[model samples]
Target: MSDTPQIHGRVEPGFEALREVFTTNFTDRGDIGASLAIYVDGRPVMDLWGGQADPGTGRPWTEDTVALVYSATKGVTATLVNRLVEQGTLDLLAPVADYWPDFGKAGKEHVTVTQLLSHQAGLPVPAEPLTRQELIDGTPVLDVLCRQSPLWEPGTAHGYHALTFGWLVGELVRRATGSTLGALVREQIADPLGLSLWIGLPQDRNSSVAPLINGRPDPAALDSITDPEVKQLALQVVAAVSDPDSLLSRTLSTNGALPTPEASTWNDERIWAAEQPAANGITNARALARMYAACVGEVDGVRLLSEDAVSTARAEQVQGPDEVTIGESRFGIGYQLPTHAAPLLGEGSFGHAGAGGALGFGNVTSRVGFGYVQNQLGASLIGEPRTAALIDALGGVLA
Candidate 1:
């Protein structure tokens, strides 16, 4: 309400440096509205949120304000899939056709659940581009995926599935569990843990959602960079994404199925109401951190997965030059592993970074679970600068 953003929430005694980093994000890093939470050994140590939830209306971000975390939703989806595996409802090594008979078609009879979750299934974009209406209805996209052929040999390489990963994995979960991904998320993950997380947000909670402010990179920013190597890398990324025929472009856009990443399409209530498990997860930092905390250890007598199950989910499934990103990437069953692309708290840290800057990760070695959500999307697809700074400060505290 004042000239300065009103910061809120608490931090444990040793974690004060995190608060300093969070404050500088508003003053220096251009963060409009954001929240960050951390859990150590399954208990919260830091919970912070601030800035304007709706700059247009002068509404400040509150503890309950949730933002749409793009690909960070993939980490949550992976958790559900692994939980099914832990319960024997789904098999990681079994062929996907075992659950969905239609998916075995188009030379994909041998693709396994592990391959799909790890992004090595070679089905990045559909053969036919889908319409926005088709994406909202959901069935048409699944049908298209069923008839689509792998762009590369299955399990030979990995690419970011972007949007299609949701439909591919969501349909598999539906056929195996007899419930939608969003329903399972609510029934199993959200309700039991009492978290304010959702894949398909309910209409009643729509008012609390923060609208994303696009932060697509500007070419002029390249001129301001002092380092030549960083500038060159940035230039190459710009070239790859600018080409409509490039793998990075086609994969991210799903061959034009998705609206431009900078567009306001994600802010629509209709999109929020639809189930897109790979994206469109509306949640705050507290729930994201707590969920990861439950995964690795226990939070309030609740553990999402056994140690063995967490190990299996975090185990490396693929690592190499990703065909889609045009850079090195790493993945486990469904989580992004530590790499230059997303150097999440060093080794034993596994989580996913969203399209914008939202990130969530769990570090097994340190017994830390971290989550950061923001209304203003950052330019970098991975290794978002604001989260990077917070993580750096966290490293200092941990050391």
Candidate 2:
């Protein structure tokens, strides 16, 4: 691969530094194919994409190329739920059983929508192992979640619900709106904002999706890091997540649903067609940024969430050492609050990072929305270095 990959897209005059950072990601940071986009005050400031869509086929990453954004889908899912809250269709404080009575089983009778969204409901993983077919079918997965008991007392602690969060929340949306989460994403959020995002991608659009080149961290890379503190932190994270019996591992894998650490199963079309609200969201950087931009301010006269709603969504709901990721973690209603794991534009910024490197977030203080998607998957449980570099450059530009 050439050190200088041909980069595409425009940057607003003042945001030229972002383009440089984007280019550096390919040349220096091991980015295979990726797109980065930013919007400030409801206007596009930077839109860039480059590298190969399929390195094997020699297909160049185009403006329309979309990639699966793993758990970054959580941010999008959070937006949908919050929108329902804003419209008075779903109440945050109401028991989830009010919508789906079966969710009330197994000591979950009192699990509120707020607690579930905030990752405080303690339904991190189902007790039994689930097959990929079962997950794609959706019904078997929902049945398992409804019957499983919480790992801890709901609202007493928090853990990342890597896979189950989708079914738990989607069931509520389904019962309340008589529509699937994917349909709501299109009718309520994507279509209104003119975004190319989808929780359940269509068959015709499948060809436009970029296949992921999944990977994990190299021990040699960690050993070579010059910063002692950074190296130690990286090593610790790798150890915790790699341990099969650890909460991080079980929660991420859904107790053997995704047995592989690399999770190459995501590359399958069947998974892409299914609705996994907490994961498997297919989109480009432009759509992701625009979606978040609308959250904080108007975009083309469309505002997804009002100022008061944004405030409520971003207000800290939980904080402390995370039981799943084993680090300091924080959350708002359904959005991830800024922490060492996900340093999303500092205070008043909320978003979620995926299992790989995908990220999307909106900052209320700066009226900024940022999105990044890539086919190259990174292993870092916390923030990936490539994203950290781009965010630092963006922060410099804002300063």
Candidate 3:
């Protein structure tokens, strides 16, 4: 593919420099393909791509090539939860049991939607044996979650929910609206706003998506943790992640009809599909940046959320060593807000870094929404080289 921009959009002062980050590493490090976009104040400024849509066939990455965002889709899902709050159907502060009564069992009656959103409901790293098949069908997995006991006391400490974040939040949406989270997202968030994102994709659109290649694993992360149980859990997460056929793998693989992991398949026909709102958002850089830009700009003639709401989304909701993330991580109600006290994620920015290397976040201070997705997944929790370059260039752009 030519170095010409992959998607059309207005370019901001620092955007071309940001593109260089991808171009340099993308070419030097060797990339199958990548697309990037940047939006500021509701207008797209930069969009570009290089490499192959199908490296296997030497198919060029085109103007519309979209890649699987691994876990970057979580940002989109969190946006829906905010919209639910905006529409008044779901209260972020309400108890989980309020929507699904059975969820109240096992000392979890007090866990609020806000708490769950912040990964403080204490059920991270589920204790029960959950099969990929059961999780593929959300209802069964939820049945187990409802009965499962908390690992830590509710609100006592927070741990990253990893895969369970979607189930916990998605289940609440299902009970509150009587529709799957995917359906509600289509109806309320994407369609209305004209965003190309999807929580669960349909089966027909599979061919357009680029296959995900999880990045090289860091040997240090493997060697550091000595706990047998924690290591086992991490191992399970890693193994499930490598195969597109795993339950969560489906969203990244073929069988694109549903966003659940079990739908993933390694075959060619299974390669592309819709953006799974939780972790399988299939989007181009242009769309990714613009989506967040809308949050900072006028969103379909409406602001994504009022300044107050955005403030709430970005403010520190849970602090201290995260129970799940269990490091310097900080979380806002439904977003990741790193504190000045701990800035591993990003400072004054809000969003999530997808598993592997995909990342999307909005800088409230700069009113910037940036997204970086790559076929080469990185092990860094927040981002890899592509994203780091983008951020550095963005800083220079601002400077």
lDDT of 3 by residue, 1-399 (tens): 334323323456646776666677665444557777766666666766767676677767776666677567777777778877877888877898999898999889999988898878876544455554555556665777788888788888877676677777888888899887778767765676666566665676566666766455566775576776556655765675566555334323322333322323312332333222456567666666766776666744756666777777777777766544334567786677755332422575787776556677777677777776666555532225556666677777776
Per-residue alpha-carbon lDDT of candidate 1 for residues 1-399, written as tens digits (9 for 90 to 100): 123577899999999999988988888777889999999998999999999888989888998999999999999999888899999999999999999999999989999999999999888777787788788788998898899889899999999898889989999999999999999998878888899999999999999999999885655677877677667767777898889888778778767667546538889899899999998889989988999999989999989989999899989999988878766789999999998656777888988888788889899988898999999888863347788899999999998
Q: What TM-score would you give candidate 3 relative to the actual structure?
A: 0.81
lDDT measured at residue 104 in model 2 versus the true structure, 0 to 100: 93
lDDT of 2 by residue, 109-227 (tens): 99999999999998887778888698788899899889989989998999888778888888889999999999999999999988999999999999898898877566577656777
TM-score of each: 0.96, 0.96, 0.81
For residue 154, give model 3's deviation from the true position in Å: 0.9
Q: lDDT of candidate 3?
A: 0.65
In model 3, the runs with Cα more than 4 Å from the true position are 1-14, 217-277, 339-346, 380-383
Clashing residue pairs in candidate 1, if any? none
Worst 10 residues of 2 by lDDT: 255-264
